[model samples]
Target: MMNSLKHITCAFALAALLALPQFAPAAEAADQPQRPILSVDGRGTANTEPDMATVAVGITTYATDAGKAQNDNAWVAGEIQKAIAQLGIADKDIQTRNYSFRPTYRQDKGHENEINGYTVDNTVIVTVRDVKLTGKVIDAALSHGANEISSLDFSASNTQGVRKEALRSAVNDARDKANVIASALGKKIVGVQNVSESTGYLETRRFAGNMMLAMAKDVETPVAPGSLSLSANVHIDFILSD
Candidate 1:
């Protein structure tokens, strides 16, 4: 009787263990139903006129003596600054961008290691708050001992409003695309799952080469303040529902 009772208890335990459910494999679990998502990209652009300009002017001088080279460069730079200031530009707007004093080497076969002369370079960045003064500033700097015009760039003073407008347009474009896709799939967009964005603006750049600087002293420089294009891009992941 004792052996029979023990056998019955073991059989009951084995049956209970077999009744428990088995776990599915990872691949099988992945095949289960999931929420549908739609991803799309949208772009928008806004145009606005540039309101300000920046000019980079430099003076370079070479001499056998380092002190003379530095002195000549400083004098020329000071004259250029004075000319810019006379155009109603405040002292704060004129900033020194770069200054370098280095020795030049003779590239001849017999004197490759000999120091030929010393060179000094001084560059200043001038901000013209008024767009109309862009040409005047360039001409003034060139006429007043500025030998090198590195770069000139035009930009808007305030880009906040235009950027916001572009962002709104980008969002609208994304929504329109999402709606079209969802309608084609016999589903409706229920909500937005994720969103990401990037924004940028293009500047109107003008480069003044050596020839342009040489001729600028004879004629008034001409500057065209072209419009700037600000762009926004957005990626949206939308949830779809039947």
Candidate 2:
């Protein structure tokens, strides 16, 4: 009986310990203070002379027969390619962008457009290493029967390097603005809380009315590739203190 009583008492003690209520970790205090912050956006632009120029030359030919049209276009395109090569452009820089053989249609009285002849257009995009050679390169292609300038653009070769400079300027601009605002409010900026950057791009302008050079005489074509603008935007949050 004594042994039985001792075992029963031990089991009751173990059951009492297991029945205690459990509690979860406490969450953040509800009355905590939020740090005062100043949010600002800054924009900066850096301009650099472009080192490269992109131009597209197109050869268009028309003939009654499709084969003749293709042949003429191919011959002119080959000549234009040779001309560009003579202008010191690398073979890799010359890329074929478009080739199309389509039937030309003429409007007939009270009828659907009638097929008059076959037309073939072959175009190539060329990147000029030197901006000064843009005019000469176009003139060379024109002399070889390239009649169309589809697209033209100029851009800085070292865009990333230029962009880095722009980003630094933007950050500096943000800090300056923050300092001005903080001084006005009689508060001082203590620390940086967060920073973010937007997607930046290079802005290049097109060469306007440049195709008219094909009609001019032996004069060297004048091309002015204006400065290229590299821009960046930054958003910053800074802590404010009294």
Candidate 3:
């Protein structure tokens, strides 16, 4: 009777050990998932003419007295504002960006340590709707009291349409590249698994030199708002079908 009981316990233990391997496969299947077939990146570009421009203008005034410097700066700023108004620019379009007072530095003599004068700086930003009037507005600002011209940038006022076009181009580029790869591998593209898009901005540069700035001086300054190019990139993952 004792030998029979021991033999029965050993047989049950062997059966449990055989069943454990079957359960391991179910756990492994739950942990693992399918992976993608192919991945690629594509780029596209589109060019268009800019419709708007931004102008940065300013004045720098210096005097021995602090009050004099402040008065000069205020006067110049007023004149600049008047000029912008004369150009028919909206009041909201003109923005004051900076105002500051700094002591002028003198060097190279026995009195080099002394402060020579007080200087005041006032800067303004102006947005122009008409590209043709960009030069005219800049000239007007300078004639009024703006002595220094900082920067002029041009860009598209409405960029939504162009951005959509660029995105479409990028998608097409990705598809074309995937087709070529599939053909080389003797396989067909089944579908897209993932896609992502990125964009690039267009910028315009300003030239530096001595120029004339008088309201009555009606000589149109040759302003060339060059073409702007926007770019887009798309990363795609494609599944291959045999």
Candidate 4:
């Protein structure tokens, strides 16, 4: 009888242990305190004068003979290249972009497309380091048989430096605004909890160099690079203490 009573007691203890509830993640999260966080976004922009200019210049020619068309294009392209070399621009700055010969088409009164002649085009992309002489380069090319101008883009030579400056400015801006908000709410910043950045750059737009000459200028084509802007944005989370 004594042995049976001890066995029963042991069984009862084991059953009590199995009936106890498990402590889970749901219960742990309820015990945690909510942290006071201040969130803000800040933006900064920096503008500077561009120092480099890139222009696409080319010559297009048409002739009944395919060989003649290519020859004419090469001759005119050669003259333009010589003029560019005389301007003290480095040989590496001139890069041949496109050279092609295709059949020219004409639509007759019957609405049928007819091949009238062959057209040849030769183009070069030039990177001019001196922004001030952008107008002179355009003038030189036009005077020497560069008839098709596709695009002109201006930008700074040292873009990395400008980008860093913009990011630093963004961080400073975030700190300043956070300080203002915290002071207004009767709180102080205990420390920085998180930081994130959103960076952006406005791609430089292309300008038509040929159209600029239509402005009736007796001198070299006048070009104004204006200014380029480098921008950055940052989001900061600061822990608040009151």
Question: Highest lDDT, which number?
Answer: 1
- lDDT by residue for model 3 over 55-133, one digit each (tens)? 8887899999989999999888888888888888898988888888999878868878788889998888888888888
Q: Which stretches of candidate 3 lie over 4 Å from their true place?
A: 1-36, 202-219
Ten contiguous residues minimizing lDDT sum, candidate 2: 21-30
lDDT of each: 0.87, 0.84, 0.82, 0.83
- Give per-model CA RMSD: 6.5, 5.3, 6.0, 5.5
Per-residue accuracy of model 1 over 189-226 as CA lDDT, tens digit each:
99889999999865565656764565465678878777
Candidate 3: pairs in clash: none
Of 1 and 2, the candidate ranking higher by TM-score: 2
Which portions of model 4 miss their true places by more than 4 Å? 1-34, 110-113, 209-218
Cα displacement (Å) at residue 209, model 3: 7.6
| TM-score of candidate 3 versus the correct structure, residues matched by position | 0.76
TM-score of 2: 0.80
Q: Which stretches of candidate 2 lie over 4 Å from their true place?
A: 1-34, 110-114, 208-218
TM-score of each: 0.75, 0.80, 0.76, 0.80
Give the higher-lDDT candidate: 2 or 3. Answer: 2
